[model samples]
Target: MKNLQKILKYALNYKKYALLNIISNILSVIFELVAMLLFIPFLNLLFNEKTVIVSSLPQFSFSKDYFEAYFNFTMNQYIADNDKLAALYFVCVLVGAMFLLKNLFRYLALFFIAVMRTGIVKDLRKDIYNKILILPLSYYSEEKKGDILSRITTDVQEIEFSILNSLEMLFREPISVILSLAVMIAINPHLTLFSLILLPITGLVIGRLGKSLKRSSSRVQQQMGVLLSTVEETLTGLRIIKAFNAEESSNKHFDQQNSSYASLTLKMTRKRDLASPISEFLGAMAMVGLAYYGGSLVLDGNSDFNGGEFIGYIIIFAKLIAPVKAFSSAYAIVQKGAASADRVDAILSAKNPILEKENPEILNTINENIHYNNVSFSYNKSDIVLNNIDLKIEKGKTIALVGESGGGKSTLADLLPRFYDVSSGAIEIDGINIKNLSLHGLRSLIGVVTQESILFNDSVFNNISFGTNNASREEVIEAAKIANAHEFIIQLENGYDTNIGDRGGKLSGGQRQRLSIARAVLKNPPILILDEATSALDTESEKLVQDALTKLMKNRTSIVIAHRLSTIQNADEIIVLQKGEIAERGTHSQLLSQEGIYKRLSDLQTFSN
Candidate 1:
């Protein structure tokens, strides 16, 4: 219920439409009640075979008897002046007008509700997406990609179907039921009281089943996420599965997850489907009991309870059943929707650790140097990745970081961009703590080309100009020339405008790497971080990418992480990291003279070559 309340809070954003909808529903209920109650006068006219006419109007008051007396006096005057057939014409016209206005208001209510429902859904999707963009990268490490995708796609859709579809019933049905029940009680309080006794029993049965359905629905949604995760993994690892000849194993794994999801859905559907029929059955039992009791009063020669009014009371009570049943069904669906709401709220309410200060300085340029002052970091408190490391790289100097995998080379570079903040110490830029600067302004001064060469399925021009907005074609081509990607790009079907397929799959490895370099070149920041940029390339591609890296590094403060020691021999200084500590720091000759870890690593690579 709290989850549903949280989901509905978004509706407040469009209060105008919600207010209009409520007003329209109230008017519609009133007109519908008036239309149904008019049948009582028609019954009285046919059965009594007599007419009582009032000569003058009574003084008006706000009692039910006063309104009834005034209405009866008006009807009596018209029937006395004309024949019963004329009065019949008047009644028919009045009933038709009532129904017409009732339906008009009902449509208007639906019109306003439509705007509110879709607008809330749109706002929900936008909020979820915006939250996803700002959540720190560490959040993705613990959550499966497919589960997150399911929350945004299928979980949201379930909310729209199960909860939003019930929005109208939640609003309108209570008014309909209350108004009809009020009229029933006015006709005979004894019968209405007897009917009320049976309703709570029906509600109890439905409420119990609704709770069970919610639990099952939660399981079904979780299984759906697992099923989607299996599918995503299969798609991403299709090549590996085929190469290993493990298609049979993959199919069996997917089948098990699919079967579990189907079984849970079946149970949830059975529970949800039982709500309507059982409620209808219980309502019928109550209605039968009321008929027996009410009929006894009329047949016992009770003058106060006439046959016409008794039949009218029964008619209004019958109308009340429809809305009661609708509300019960909606209750069941809302329980199911609450499960989905919980899933979406998990993301919307997730805490983001990467917070910017209220009044942070903007970093415009790097004048001095970047200093890592006793910096230490850990993904977890017990497992440190970088330990009390202190280093500095002056402006216009190149410093290289060489370490074994998992020794925190990439983690060290990532901290500078605030992908994850340092666990313990501070990184300062030009003697100012990086945390004291705006995130955008700080990251804007640094350019990175990573090993993955992350590219989108867009035109080469758009991909290259992705973050660097308003880049002219001439500037893009110039950057491409610097990265040595212009020759191959022009040979493509549409040159710079050519659409690279998913993740640049249509291009060769060298082309993708070079395009990523071209993007960095376009940004042309004063500081650059190259994380094993040439580690995965073949000899020819490495040579091409390495040459581009050399040109891009000229006169810029550069931090290079490399596995190949030959590439960084020309670096001004090389820092060798071992077990998250600086083991050696010097030029190529100076490090070799130490004959320590850097010397051993360089000798081993030389032997391997």
Candidate 2:
């Protein structure tokens, strides 16, 4: 119920529809009760032989004048005119009309319930997607993609059907039960009180059983997330699985996760199923008790208790059972929905670790210099990835970062784009700290190409124009030519329109890398960061890409992270890093003369060549 309160806050905005549904449910219950009670008068009219008027009853008696007045009016208007034939026809017609009206209002109530149900579902999914888009990249590094996807789809669907729909039933069914009970008590208080005594016992059983269901449901949802994440990872790396011939190993891993999920689901289902039969059994026992007591009172010839009223009491009691069943079932659904709400809340309540300061300045363009002054950083309080790094690049100069792996080469490149902030220092473009600049403005001024080419499942033209929405076809083709991608792109089945499958899988590795470079070229930023852009290509592809890279780097303030020693030989200056510190800094020829780490790296590459 607490979880229901939280979800209702979002649903509260559509109160008009909820109110209308409530009114319709009330009307439906009223009409249904009227239909059930109509049988009392009609039965008395048919069984006139033993029909006991109020004045004729021995112990239970009314004043003769009042009883005669009511009796004469009923006989003259209804029973005496048509006898049993007329009474039976009248009861059938009246009951049928009441039922028709009840069903009509019931349909209208459910229609509005559907509106509120789907509206809330739509709003929740939209909010979750928007939050995901605004969340920091660092957030993704610590969470699984499949878990997030499951929250948006499976978890949200659970809330819609189980929670919202259960609320609709909860509101309508309880009202129906109450209305039916009122009619039952009016006819015979003794039977109504006897049946209601079983209610507290049923409540105690339900309370105890449902106490653990919410906790178990939460565990089930979490296990499902794990299974979904495992399947996602397996699909993403299926090629590797086949290449390594690890099919049996992958199947065993999947089976383990699948079996765990199955066990949790079975447990949750057992807990949910417990509510139904327990409620029904209690209701049936109450009915049996009523039948024995009411039959004995009628057989004793007590004029106070007549056969027709007894029959009406039984019909009303039967109506009460359905709503009681619904109440118990809806309670179970509420528990399941509560579990899902907690998962969604976890994602929505998470605070972004990286955010812009208030009233941040916007930097439109860079003119003077890009400076890294005593910059240091660490991720998650671990060993420093960068330490007191100091460097400067004039507006139009090429500075190459040459270092071994894990030497913070790519980390430095990432900072220039503000993908991360320095832990203890500042990075500035044109003397203004980048942290002070608008995030959008800071990213718009730089372009990046990494070792792994990041492209989507789209046409070649869209891939190149991804960063520049208004780029013309001619501009796109020119950027492709500069990236040495035009020749292969035009030869495809659909030329620029050809679909590059997921992650550009339909293209070769070199082709994908060139397309990434083309995307950067189309963006045409003042500062470009090439992080080992040619390291993954073969000799011939590297030569072609290096030529394209030379064309792209011309007149741009470029930061190149080079792995191949020969690639940075003509760089303006090369900095060699060792364990988050600069070990050597010089031109290629001067570094060779120093006979240090850079020299050894160059010699090794030379021998390999």
Candidate 3:
């Protein structure tokens, strides 16, 4: 029910459409009642059950007595003057007109609902997309891309199918049942009362099936998430799979999930499909019982109804069955819809942001320095990744961190941008605690380039000017030249306009890294963080990128996670990290003279090559 309220919040945005749909549906129900009751007059004409009137035609009035008396008198007058055939034609034509009006209003009602449902789908998807963008990076690390995508795709679609489409029926079907019940009660109150008694019993049976359907629905949706995750992993690792010849293993895993999903879907279908027929059967039996009771009264002259009137009562009673059956079916759909609503709510309600305080100081520029004061960090809280770390980086100087692969080098750099907050202590910029600074403003002063050289499937120009969308062509070309990327970019098929395939696949590793450097150059931040920028390239490629890196690092406050010892020999300072703590701190020569952890790592890389 809480999830349902959340879903309703999205619906309420277009409340005018919802209200109009209800109004239209109410009109449709009224017209349908008019059409159905026409049968009563038609039955009287066919059976020739005449009621002689000594009084003249009653004046037209809003009262029920006037309406019933006046309409009967008019029908009888036509029968006496013309013939039964003319009167029957008039009633038929009247019924057809009422049906035409009913359907017209129903069409208008459906039109409004279609607009609302489609709008809600578009806006809801947009909201989820915006939320995913603003979510902290750690959220992505902890959650699967496939499952998040499934919530936006499959689960949202389920809500559209079972909830949005059912909105009209939610109003239409119930009002139809109510109006039909009213007419039946007007004709024979006792029989209507008897029929109403059977409904709660039928509801209990349908309600049990609805609960079972919801359980199956939730399982099916969960299995779909797992299946999506499998396919996503397979696609992302297709290259590795082919290299290792693990197609059979992948297929076996996929088959297992697919079979499980199919079984759950089969169960949900059976449970949902069972509700309608069961309700319909129960309704038919109640109608049969009503026939026995109502028939006895008519035959014994215990009721005012003649044979035709009794048959008319049965016909109206039968009409009520359709809406009753629809109500049961709707209950099943709502159950399925609720399960989907829960999935969507999970994403919207997620608390992932490294929240900033109100009235946080705007940190638009870098001046004095950055400070890490006795900082310790953990991802899961059970294992610390960086422990008791303290470092200072002044403006207009370079500091290089060197260590093993998992020595918390990258994690320390990440703190500067607040990608993950420190579990203890704090990082200060100049004098103010970084947590007191606006997140957007603080990140704006920093630039980063990583070993992977993340790029997009886009044009070369767009890739270079991604964050700086307003960058002029001259600015981009200059940035490229500084990073040594301009020469190769000009040699491409379309120069700056060349389309780089996924993750810059169309370019060499050196070319991709150069573009990454060019992107950082364009941002032109006061502070730059390079995480092993040339570690993945060949010797020749490394030389090309390293030269570009030297040009990029000149006269800037830079933090370099040096993978190759030779590249950072001239750093202003060197800090060596070992297992989660700083083990050594000095110049390159100073570290070598210490004969410590830094010296051993430097020797291993130099000779192992």
Candidate 4:
């Protein structure tokens, strides 16, 4: 119940509908109780029992005169005629009518409750998805994609089905039990008192069982996350697993996780499953005892105990069992839902370490220099990836970064687009700190092409025009041509409309890179960051990509990170980084002549003189 309270805002949005459901449920319970109570009159006719007649209805300020009049009138008419069969038939018909009306309103109440429940679930899912999209890149580094995916799909669904559904039952079933009990007490107070004794014992047992279910459910949900993440990883890297011939190894890992998940699930299910049978057994015991005690009193001819009234009391008592069973089952579901809610709340309440400042400045375009002033960064607390890095690039010049792996080449490239912020110092554009700029405005100023060419399972044109919405056919083709991808795109059976299968697996590595370059070209931002964009290409593909990159780099402030020395030899300035700091900086010829880190790297690449 407390777990549900966390998301009350979403639920409260449709409070009017929820109120209607409650009203309908109350009406349903009233009608249902009326249907059960109708049995007393019918039993009296069948058994020829003494009429427990009251001359006037018990006086209460709120009691309506019409209700008392109707009751007296019916009783008098039955007594005067003494037609037992006709009275039984009339009571049976009235009972049937009340039952029918009860079922109708019950259906309507459940339908409206479902609407409110599913609507909140839908809104919650949409909010989570939007948060995923807007969250900083750093958030993903420590989180698993499959875990997040499970939260959105699996955990949320559990909350809807188990949590909210339980909440509905919690409301409706208790009202039913209370209404039925009221009628039972009205018929026979002594019998009602006998039945009430078991409630405390039942509550204690249920409480003891529920105490462990929430913790067990939480463990089960976590194991499920691990299992799902493992499966996701296996599927995404299936080709690698096959290529390495490690299917047996992968299966062992998957089986271990699967077994753990199964064990936890079995434990949770056992706890959840225990509630119904245990509750039923307790209810049965209470009913058997009540029947014994009441039967003894009736056999002794106690003035308050009558055969027909006792039968009606038993009938209403039987009705109480169903609601009790429902509540016990709902309690288990609520525990499971609480466990799920905790997991979801952990995510929803996570503090994003990186957030845009208030009253952020907006940059429509980058028309001046981009500066990295003593920028230092670290992914973890242990070691710095970049340190004391000072560099500047004019608006329309090309700057290239060259370094060995772990020398912060890619990290430096990432900082230009603010994919990550500098740890120690600031990055600024046009003398304004990048942190002060709105995230959308800062990112809109730059385009990136990374080593891995990420594309969705979509058409070529759609992939290229992804960033720039509503791009025309002519504009797409022009960008493709500039990327050296137009020729191959046309050669495909569907040309620009060709579907690039998952991650562009249908295309060759070079072709995928070309498409990625085309996507960046389509956006045509003022600044470009190409991180080893052509490193994985063959000589022939490299020539084409290098030509495409030359065209794209023109009149744009481009920052290129390269492993292959020949690719960036013609840059305006080249910087060699070593151990998180600038080791050397100069033009290509000057660095080559100095025979330092840059010259050593160039020589190691076996570049032509």
Q: After superposition, how far is residue 529 of candidate 4 from its true place, in Å?
A: 0.9
Which candidate, 1 or 4, has the higher lDDT? Answer: 1
- Predictions in order: lDDT: 0.90, 0.84, 0.87, 0.84
TM-score of each: 0.96, 0.89, 0.96, 0.94
- Model 4 TM-score is 0.94
- Give candidate 3 misplaced runs (Cα > 4 Å): 52-63
Residue 608 of model 2: what lDDT? 88
Question: Clashing pairs in model 2?
Answer: none
RMSD of 3: 1.9
How many residue pairs collide in each prediction?
Answer: 0, 0, 0, 0
Task: Put down candidate 3 lDDT per residue, 426-541, tens digits, no spaces.
Answer: 99988789999998888888989999989999999999998986999999999999999999999999999999998898999999999999999999888899999988899999
**Per-residue lDDT over 333-386 for candidate 1, one digit per residue giving the tens place of the 0 to 100 score:** 899999999999999999999999999999898999999999999999999999
Residue-level lDDT tens digits of model 4 in 1-609 = 555578657888788778889889999999987777666655765777766555554545533334434555676577668776677777789889998999899998988898898889988888888778767788888888878887888889888878788878877988888878777766677778888997666767877787688889889888878878898899899999999999999999999988998899899899989988888888888889889988887778846667777887887787888888778878777877788887787677777766799999999887789999999999887978998999999899898999889899988988866777789888999999998999888889899998989899999999999989899999999999999999999999899999989999899988998899898999999999999999888899989998999999999999999989899989999989999899998899999999999988888779554
Ranking by TM-score: 1, 3, 4, 2
